[model samples]
Target: MKRLLTILLLTLCVNLSAQTLRKYSNEFMNIGVDAAALGMSNAVTAFSSDVNSGYWNPAGLVNMEDKQLALMHASYFANIANYDYAAFAMPLDHDSAIGISLIRFAVDDILNTTELIDSEGNINYDRISKFSTADYGVTFSYSRRLPIDGFNYGVNAKVIRRVIGKFANSWGFGLDAGVQFESKNNWKFGLMARDITTTFNAWSIDKEEFAKVQDAVEGQNQELPETTELTIPKLQFGIAKKFIYRHDFSILTEVDLNIRFEQNNDLISTSVASINPAFGFEVGYIDMVYLRGGVGNFQNELQIDNSEKIGFQPSIGIGFKYNCIQVDYAFTDIGDQSVALYSNVFSLKIDFDCFR
Candidate 1:
């Protein structure tokens, strides 16, 4: 039965990959939720050791020494959207941990307009409306240290929901798995498989209401259809090393490689160009003040026009920790030359065990 389940999971992933093609579904899942992780260009697969580890690599949850609660918020695309996350984690036993997290991404106060016009050719301002679009996800994660000295394994189950005003909505389910290994020399290696079960979203549309609006508007032929969308699986591998100097200062560096399998004319390409790589470095002083920087999303061709091209996205962040409370901030470049296009993330965490 175990082998049969594995086969079914692989088949589902392949089918989802074929259906998604070049498009990404449930893309909000890709957004980094932790300010500290974002500051490191999301290269924390092997460097996870905090509350947010549940989102990066569930196996890393085992590294926490006590119960933790964390909260984060970010503004994206010039304040057009807001993203927020919250999580709590606790050790279940000597060798195992459990965590739960919630994520919300939303765009509010959007102007909704229909073409219900008067016979006098004047636009009816009263017919205009306002609505909001939002996406939400909740994840439950569990991790355990394996019998092997420095090995750990973890899994995450997630439920997702998306709403577009009152016109359409979708619900989805997905699973993720991860493993981590630590060497005696303090080197860490991590592997994560996201959407291993082929995340599936079933969308329901209000076609009757949509049809009424279409009829009110002249020359409108758009129709709504109920459909299901899939989010393909993605794999990530990472390595990290840390250096401690005289117990007063420490430096850590990590690199992560991400792989996405997409079908091109029914062929899968595992070439170098298809792999996305991210790099990060962190410096800590007296375990209080921290500085971080990294680069990622190396796009070969990000064209503003026919001649203008941009390269990879870069990020920097700072952190401070005092007692059981920690605060982190990160700034990410979103590829636009305009300053308004940048994103900012802020996070706070508290550990209850500090007082124990």
Candidate 2:
């Protein structure tokens, strides 16, 4: 009860302290194409799998061995170049792994035109179409176990870029820090600090002349241009437990309490953070096949706000394992304003156990 109360108090404080909500950043675009299956469904952390361990819980890299490497690619739920991402992790020695990820969100071709007044009112002409704005990010990560027992940590540095025709282009940096722990009984605790830096020169405001026209209409000589900076969330706390049922069957569940703070201010803000509960089980009487299903919230690419929604994202997956190699695939629903789309998540992971 005390733990629960502490959580409630933290949440209340977060909500009351925030003054304004943040707008979108390039990082959100790729987050929509969250692959690694269980990571999306359960708000995954401290859950260790060779492939997604790079993105979800870096500390899980402690589980990697045999000079292992895992790669995953999510095709994205929508075909509109919304959100797509790919990640890979390679382990060396004990408690150490190297990871990399790439993400992109492209706004498909959009007609660029200006209103033209003709004799019969206003007629729009083919003003030539250019690819809509796009955002991309690349991440490199490293993780290791600490000298303390049952403790491990990781960090990631990312390069972010935004492109919007000839109008807006910017480059920036972001950082991530994560920690994880596992008890003898298999309980898990995890925390991650995400996008802790400010990416600068996020947009182009060379259209000062247009602003002047608008200012003339508004009767003001000066107009404050929108801030051309991208804001990213600060923290995410995650927890989960693994239940090994029978000899070969197992179940996993997790939750994440995401918190965001105001840029350049001490204020903070939060929402329920959406609850993503996932379940998985093994198939085949011999435990060679794995089946997975889950639900959770995923960001939208076009929308500037990383709003939270519930009961909308769902996933189903299947996996096959032989020797030390595993191949897995998952189908996910991508919800949107107009129509919800679908995507495929494919992963490959190789594991080795010295004691086995």
User: lDDT: which candidate is best?
Assistant: 1
After the best TM-score superposition of candidate 1, give how far the Cα of residue 296 lies from its true spot, in angstroms: 0.5
| Candidate lDDT values, in order | 0.80, 0.56
- Candidate 2: where is the Cα deviation over 4 Å? 1-23, 27-34, 38-42, 49-51, 66-78, 111-129, 198-201, 204-224, 230-232, 261-287, 298-312, 323-325, 333-344, 347-356
- Return the top candidate by TM-score: 1
lDDT of 2 at 243: 67
- Give stretches of model 1 more than 4 Å off: 1-22, 115-126, 212-220, 263-273, 302-310, 334-340
Tens digit per residue, CA lDDT, model 2, 1-356? 22422332232222222323344444453253334443245466656545455566566665666445555565444565565566667676676878777777776574433222244555546533343657778778888888988888888787877665443456767677788988888778888777666443344433642332332232333333453455555566777786666777766666665555533211122253332233323233245677666655433333337553333466667778787777777776635322446766676766654325
Q: In model 2, state the lDDT of residue 49.
A: 47
**Number of backbone collisions per candidate:** 0, 0
Q: For candidate 2, which ten residues in a row score worst on lDDT? A: 263-272
C-alpha RMSD of each candidate structure in angstroms:
8.5, 10.8
